[model samples]
Target: MDFEKIVSDHKCRSCIISVERYQDGGFGNIRVVAANKAHREDSERVFNHPFVPDSPYTDSLPQDKNFEDFMYRCACLGQPLHTYVHVEHMGLWVNMFLLPLESDKENIGYCLYSCDISPYADSEQQASLSAETATHVLEISIKLQGAKKDDIRQVFRDIIEDIRKICGAEHCCILYHDITNRKYINFCEAMNPQSPLQPDAIYNNEKFYDIANSFDSAIRGSSCLIIKDEHDLAWLESVDPDLYSLLLENGVKSGILFPLKHNDQILGYLWALNYNVEETVKIKETLELSTFLIASEIANYQLMKQLEILSSIDILTGCKNRNCMNNYVDDVISGKAELPEPYAVVFADLNGLKRVNDEKGHSVGDSILRTAAAILSQVFYDCDVYRAGGDEFMLIIKDGDVDETSIKSKIGQLKEKSAIDTDVNFAAGYYIANKGEDIRTAMRLADEKMYIDKKEYYAKHPELKYR
Candidate 1:
């Protein structure tokens, strides 16, 4: 590697690390910082490496803090360390305060400090890269504050643009996993962004499960993997040349995939591609730390998605509940959830439900209510079903031409199957709106019609025996 080019471009000192087995089963690295103006090596001078303890540096430590004192003292006494040393242990990196002493400064009891420890983890000469990354993230987040959902996405795009400017990488993808859909949805802020993987807009449940399984296996085995590579690209080229060309044309080179995990489960994976960059694609400590924070953010977004789904779904019947109904209507009124030209609202009331509760036990009544809900849900085809109230259900059908024959057949089947001695009849009224009309008015009309139908039924069957 040409060290000078890296130094010039990134404006930071570079180091090559040689890893050996760690003492406590963790990884350890020996960093040999690039030769700069600061420390011209003298063959006669002796200096202790950062990793070693009990060097001359440990001597100045307070008696109360044994381990840290010993470690620093070791560095001071054993070697001529021109810069501060950092050690990562137990999930924290601690930087020791050290300075290079000049020949005149040593006699004068003073030394010159070279770099800022607060900006970077260790050293004065190397730039504090992670602090810079954090500042960029914070600035972007502040700009996105109080923005709408769409605007927030735009902010993310802007952030990625900044990243591209700094890192000179191509093809970054932010995938939002919909646990409800059991899929990974590609979220892009750019309007009309062409999907590279078309025909498969999202990776479904089975595919997500496969990725999750692979992730778990790798975690257990402590093995790293690159899911997509040149071979995969070649295969895609063989099968779908246009898609392959599209991917290549878009400057998608090598990609780094890290699973976004929450509550110990992988929600999704974030992918960043190298494109034309020649930097080593290896995961660094700083990048790993950033990934942890990113994973948390992604997890939070996924959690909100789940909460949104839960808000819409009825916990009891697995249908759109009252809250969902309200949201649906709001969406329809606001033109968010678009409806067909001719929409129909069917209001249904289960007859003799209160009588059943009065005669039979509440358990039986509960069972009857559940059965009625199930029947209504099963009878309605491609309609939004809601258990609006006790013994009252609502169906919002997008297709206005709901087959009356099919609904009658379903009611007949329920009447035959119901074991309750009382007549298992239900009063239902549907109001179709040909032109765009208020959903509330349609619902009210259907409800009034249902009551009228019930009244007529009771009036005609006055002589029939009551349950």
Candidate 2:
């Protein structure tokens, strides 16, 4: 019988690995000779290699004495063997069968077939454990879904703690990427109390970006990454010595890092450190279900925050809008707000806005508004600046001594600066409120005084008077 042909013709769900006896009495290097289509794809994905005829078996087997002795017994006894084995590298439990092939009354080789039986191992117990973990993850998802913006950090802290426990890890942390700020924020973290690693730590260095870039390139489409030893750290060290040293300093002998992806974008990374091989496998499987929910929750929270910001900001001037002003007023009126004593209100309107809009077009008028807002922001840098109306802005000085003359000088300098380019001008008035005075009364007085300033501004420059 043609053994290779017969193996190729045999169709089953099992992946077949074949080994031939060598002249030295030991088996030749094992090779994957045949597998059904389904097994072929699974083997390639999980083991990271295709099962081609005569190709060396590269899948890592269980690293235990029992497995080594079992294989020895099978080869020595010259009898068919069958048993359950676990592939440590792939983190899979498989049902294994070995059949000896003979030629001319001599054993020449053995055919080994393995079928993945991980799902059925202690089926009842696994089902119960899976159900419990699922319920816990669902609870976290629900809390994130309903969480307020202020509560998100606490919720993430709880998630990190739970993940550390589930993974049997010494430490776990979530690193959030602040793209705009160009920093990696440690959003949350948890650690075993007796573990040497510090839970509250920051990694803010340019070298971290290099390490992240290298890691992102290496694991482009992979779901997770595991680093078991110094060999792994060598690659990291080649890319970034600082980052490698940082990890080593934290006592990270073994660790896993997985991306929190949303809509094809990586928002952050989740990391677990110092988990044993078995614990690492369990954590990987558990996170396979949990990370999706976590990513969705984070995405939703970010969306809500962005929407809130857009709703309360003036798109044209980049200042807080009238909507924000109304909310502030409501907060003060309802006694839910407190202002530092000796506050002041400044009301200002852009001069010659109608003329700029009519003569230079609305685009120029918009530019002038933005420039005016920018100047006000710089001058009243410590105050709340709001776009209160078309061509008008309000500043609420919550605390600080009122240097009226100094503020007027800054406004005069701004007017001169704008005159050289944008040719814009400002008419402004301010009213300081005593400790017991009503804020609204002070604002009204400031508005009235602003009209007086506007009249004087137009009188000095008749060419800018509104038609």
Candidate 3:
């Protein structure tokens, strides 16, 4: 067969690949037998070397098991395959096609591989999925689009379960990575009830990130890792023995992993364990399409959460802002949130904030406010602290868990500590509201008592002027 003529006829970058077959049903040495002019020219332009014939495919392209597996299936099994993939290392989208070529020799199988490269992904090419795969991907997108802000977490869990069932896997997990912290930020995993896997106990953010980080190099910079058989495991073992052992110990016989990426940033990883090995190709195809939508949705969800935190939290004092306190009060009044039978509302006013701001700069005053918040947080461990306004904080403490005596002692300790540390002083007071009592009443009484206590603070420091 004139392999050169066959590849040369193709318009795009095309090549003839030969796989060395063993008598015992194994394969080795995937070599590029011939390349079209376009392929050779492109190779020369990018790699700064001429594409030589009868060279290892890795010499021309990346050593990707997924690519090798596709070639093997096309050449040896006579199954033509087509896939549109994002080549992560090169930051390019490649539309690839594999067609089995007629081979006269049994020991050597041939496949014609052709690809059109693009800097950006083509939406039409991406949408060219099998009907079943298209349906699955479409359903996920619809669910994500319909989900409300409050429903996002549960919606994500439901999606994970759906993906797990679709892959016929024992478990499916989506683990988000915080690259700056080297931590597993968020995780959503679906598992069979009987599966002997840790639900949330075993792995922490730091401990599991090591194994996750190793997958990039273990796959030799491939976008995803598909460990279908012992051959793939052997490759992993050779590259990372410890990780290989860890997977084996965790009953990971076969798995597929795809990174949840957004705008070239790896948001996290989507992986399945003990999946149906026979459906590996279909699973990969479905997930490749599905992950695109999932990653985008997760990224938007994370962004919204960060915005919500910024809106509800006080930046200076690291406590809930007045807006958050108002919402909580509304929730309690509207019966959206139920408080216990007896509760207390406490007001903590920083006594010397104005004096500090006038004497020193506003930055020093800001530090004093933070110090006051820290002391309040330390004392009111089981309560919510809100920065109601400048130099004023509010706490809603449940009374049954902490009695009045304990609260008074803690307040006394705060006063003594603030006096010793010249940074700040506290004028704190609380009012307990029993069943059938209004929270507004407790808040008003707490505020009045706090004002009364402020006079005592002034008396304690007669030499210093009080505003």
Give the top-scoring candidate (lDDT).
3
Model 1 lDDT tens row, 88-165: 212223333323222221111212212222323433332344465556555545554544654656655765555444
Estimate, for each residue in 1-467, the C-alpha lDDT of model 3 and write its tens digit.
99988988899999999998877656798999999999898878887889999999977776678888888888887888999988877878899999999899978899999999999989999999889989999999999999999989899999999999998888899988877777775578899888886535425523466877876676565667888878878887988886677778677788888888788777888988888988887889999988989999989987998999999999998999999999988998899989876788889998777878998989999888888998888877777899999999999987455568877887887787777677687888888777678778889999999999989878888876675
Give the candidate order by descending lDDT. Answer: 3, 2, 1
Give all candidates' CA lDDT scores. 0.49, 0.68, 0.85
Number of backbone clashes in candidate 3:
0
Candidate 1 Cα misplacement greater than 4 A, ranges: 1-132, 143-167, 175-212, 216-253, 262-265, 276-293, 334-337, 400-424, 460-467
Q: 274 in model 2: Cα distance from truth in Å?
A: 2.8
Name the better of 1 and 2 by TM-score: 2
**Clash counts for the predictions, in order:** 22, 0, 0
Residues 1-467, model 2: lDDT tens digits: 45445445545545444555555444445555556666666667767766665566555333332233234334444555554433433545556566554434243344545444573344342333345566766676677777778788798898889888887889888887788987677878888988987644425544675566555554434466666556556755775566567778766777777788787688888888887655443455567557767887878877888998999999999999999998887887678898756778889888888888888899988988888888888777887799999988998887666667766775677566666655567778888777677778888998999889889877887866552
Model 3 vs. true fold: TM: 0.93
For each candidate, give its TM-score against the true structure.
0.58, 0.73, 0.93
Regions more than 4 Å wrong, model 3: 23-25, 179-182, 194-207, 456-466
Model 1: ten consecutive residues of lowest lDDT: 105-114
